[model samples]
Target: MAETSRGIGGLAFDASKRARPPELNVLIALIAIVAAFELLGRLLIGDSFLFNTRDNVDGIFNQQRLEIIILQVSIVGIIAIGVTQVIISGGIDLSSGSVVGATAMISMSFAQVALVNGQPNPKGVFLEQGWVDLPVIVPVLVGLACGLVAGLINGALVAYTKIPPFIATLGMMVTARGVARWWSKGQPISFPTESFAAIGKGLMPVVIFVTLAVLFMVILRYTRYGKYCYAIGSNEQAARISGINVEHHKILVYSIAGVLAAVAALVLSSKNLTAQAGMGVMYELDAIAMAVIGGTSLSGGRGSIVGTMLGALIFGVIISGFTFLRIDAYYQEMIKGVIIVAAVVLDVYRQRVRSRG
Candidate 1:
């Protein structure tokens, strides 16, 4: 009996000292993914995944491909950062994609230039000329307000009415999409003023995403708001009893998420120079997938902006690598689905192991 107790005590001691930061594991996975693509590129495409063997470029790396990878994912990466926070706070948001679509349409209308080549702008949404060529802030504030209202409604429903987050967000998703289509009668909104266009030019989206990520990383790690989020997510009853305003925090979290979605809309619309009702389709799913793959637990109380950023990179790398290998788009979708499920399964397994220990 004494030996048995000693053995158990030793195991516990070992387990206590074995604690590892989850981000390290995610970083390792990212490196492994990059290496895999490198190997496959050489074998299947006779080209490199990240390196440039061509003599035209002085650098050893494929700079253009690298830029494309970052640019392509930067917009969605913004949404992922918000999704990471929401998940950590034990809530789900299914309306961010729709919010992007709606905000884009509405904002673009106010951003229209008065004339195109010295003629009345053909794509103007407003019949009155006064609505055209307005200040860029007009559209920006209007767009953000749309997101804020939608988020407030979502938060109120989830926090006060006790509606399930999935149902609440799903309802907002449909409503926001309807609003998007209605905003322009299913027509695309195009042509913004020069000031508005600058918002997403070149690498601006990447800069915006990285800036937000770093800012939020600090917020989540150091602020009382961050502590409340983790606490509420880990155990709402316990947090409430401990004096954390769970309901209020929930509202704030959803509100922030909504604003982030709007930010993404602004960047996306500016980048494309147009806003279609179909814009941002399936973006919410992709954002959630990025967060999950970055090691965020869907069960809540655990996630990070940094992890989501890395996940976005992983997502971009995989897609770019597949295209470089000339893989079918259908196959690419299937593989992406597999990766999402695998990540979720791994998270569940980790949770179970932790519980058992």
Candidate 2:
């Protein structure tokens, strides 16, 4: 009888330990933020805020505002997904924003259609008579190819040339922005095929965001590649000694990041029906913030796609909340920065506590 009781107690203890959820603390913080914002919008701002409609409890469920928030963050969220992989592999990417700009310009150039019936091509801002009517696939392929090449360059510089990840990506960032401007002489490239525009129209960005998020979640959770990412991020030298092809994997990871950035550019251009050389300015910062806010460690090795998705949601909600409260746009930016810093500090403190415990 005593043996049976002991066994039951042991089982209970084991279950309790296992039941302790990871990142519960972060989740709590997120909930607090939402609740605080909701209250502020309802009481302080009244109807002046973007999200303070009296008809619907701040109208978080308002289809139009929800759609707008999703659209606004979808491109940055895509880049954040890639950045998650890079950080998990013990690296960083500062070039993704610039990649978006460059890819948009270059790809839209291929999508231009010739003017017809004196109506001019509405898809393009500069309707070049010679370059219009190209197949839809051409621009997409070109954008992806550009992304692949840029990613490869970034990977090579870091992996083969022994450059620091930050330096390599920084160089790429500048180069890509220059390429974006040079492609169209600093002018917005407008006019894309109707079919091409459909890629970023309406709910398509949300669709792509959801699909990619699911795919990456599976990849990071179940595959050997995922295992290696955690292993490398936790300890690169140890990972290499264990027979992981650290260099090749790094190259592949950054390249994948580039491809994802291109996907973002495609969606952005399609939705806007015009590609600007400055289309993705400052987007990389937002992506990084999303990843970090989701509780992904900057030190690498520990993160999840689920966390990233949640982080994106948090970001969207915060932006929406600010607008709902009628906060000035500039003030919103300042508050976001503060929140990011607070999150990071909290994360570091948590890590320390876990280690001590």
Candidate 3:
């Protein structure tokens, strides 16, 4: 190999290339997309899509729409943070969405208030039973425990049993969703304590998402765990030869992913004031999509939390833009699918270039 070329931990990288950084590229694409929407808005509705200089009163950024875009993606962005790590380790996790479903149901069952109207609660899933209203911490702990256990199971299966990541997580996905459905016998869990409800009220989800992203960004960029993940994804055989306990590292990574999913569930349930068996349907895919669009290589070994954040922003903007344009729900889904496929194709191409470089 030429001196100008070196491996990224283990994957290939060419310093000679002048290509724009992945995150920057995605940012540009997001701007282009927003501009397209704005143009369409002007042509179709004879009104501004993102600005309102017509009155010279509203802010130029369409403050309400900006808030909507950020808030809409924050819950799922938390999940994407975890998913980004998993994919960076060259592993796939299909169980996260289901983990959210399961965690939500289990935690809410504990968090439910025993009283309504200053009386024994009716519609109380736990009040009529021996399980009375527990403190908010109890439910939060329960949720975290549920997520940790589920993640540990995934790690064990993949690390010890040597099962393929896809198959293992897929099995978990089905099982966890089943658990969610069975938790309250198909009933929705609601009426959480005031403390619990406050966890994700209003702008709280965005706060939690941003804080976690910053924390993990630091960890991923500055920690041994980050290096180990890149090493494993880049080349497992070489990582093992270099004294990395590949199995333990994998378990740790998966466990982290699980806990993050649980946190997302907590925030989501708190925001909605309820938890349902179907709460997180297709969420795993959305999280994965964010990672991919953010320039996380699907083949693994290369990604960034910043890129995923931008990807999430793009996701929020696109979805909200579609709604702003009055696009139908079904059509929106189709377009999203196309975008995901395109992202994967682009990733594959990037991998090929790196391999050749």
Candidate 4:
């Protein structure tokens, strides 16, 4: 009886020592941000941040504002999903925004409707019209392939040649942007087929983002692939010694990131009905900020899909709140930069506390 009691006590003590999941902290931050906005709205404008004040609405919650917030963040959130994985695998992808630009141009060309209002597509990339109005799958596949190829190149460079991820992805960024410009000679590609356009219509982007987030969350938490990523990020030498294919896994991680970026491009272009050379400018930074704000350790070996989703929500809320307060765009940008830095600083502090513990 004495021995059993001691054992039980020890187990209880161990359990008590365990730290809470990081997502809880992020969730709290999100709630706090929302509350802050709500308070500010009431004090400053005699309005509500998330409640419907207009007489036209029957519900208390502002459904339109909620939808707008989610829709605005959904595309960039998709890119952040991939960025989360890459960062967890101990790498960065600076080329995702460029990949979006390039993929948008390339894929939209294939998805162009042969005729607009019974006339040839005025903004078509191909003059022959043969390349236009191909099946939706064709453009999707083409877009995915473009991303895959770019990702493969990024992976190969980092894994085989030992190029730093920053430099490699940066180079790819420039190259991919150039491709975006060159694809249509700096012209915009517009007028996609009905099927292609349907991909991003209404709440479709949110649906897609949520689907991918849930799927990858499962993959990262339960699969060997996820274990390898964590192991590699935690300690590359240890992972290599444990018989993991570090190079191959790194390549795979970056490749998936590229594909996700392409997915964002496809959705964005489809929704906007046009693909521009400058589409996705600074999106990489936004994706990275989302990941980092989600409690993803920039140092790697730590992060989650759930956290990223919550982070994206936080981002969306801040942006919406600012606009509600009528903040200037430049001031918003400056504040965003500060928030990003603060998140990174907090991450570093967390790492330190964990090490000490």
Residue 191 alpha-carbon offset, candidate 3, angstroms: 1.0
Show where candidate 1 strays beyond 4 Å.
Answer: 1-12, 15-18
Reference-based lDDT, each prediction: 0.90, 0.84, 0.90, 0.93
What would the per-residue lDDT of candidate 1 be over residues 96-144, giving only the tens digit for each residue? 9999999999999999998889988888998484799889999999889
- The TM-score measured for candidate 2 stands at 0.88
Cα-based TM-score, every candidate:
0.95, 0.88, 0.93, 0.96
Model 2 score (lDDT): 0.84
Candidate 2, 169-188: lDDT as tens digits: 99999999999999878888
By lDDT, the best candidate is 4
What number of backbone clashes does candidate 2 have, counting pairs of residues 3 or more apart or in separate chains? 10
Lowest summed lDDT across 10 adjacent residues in model 4 is found at: 5-14
Candidate 1 matches the true fold with a TM-score of: 0.95
Candidate 1 deviates by what RMSD?
A: 2.9
Tens-digit lDDT string for candidate 4 (1-357): 646545464653355546788899999999999999999999999999999999987898999989988899999999999999999989999999999999999999999988889998899777584888788999999999999999999999999999789999999999999999998899999999999999999999999999999999999999999998899888989999999999999999999999999999999999998999999999999999999999899999999999999999999999999999888878889999999999999999988987896
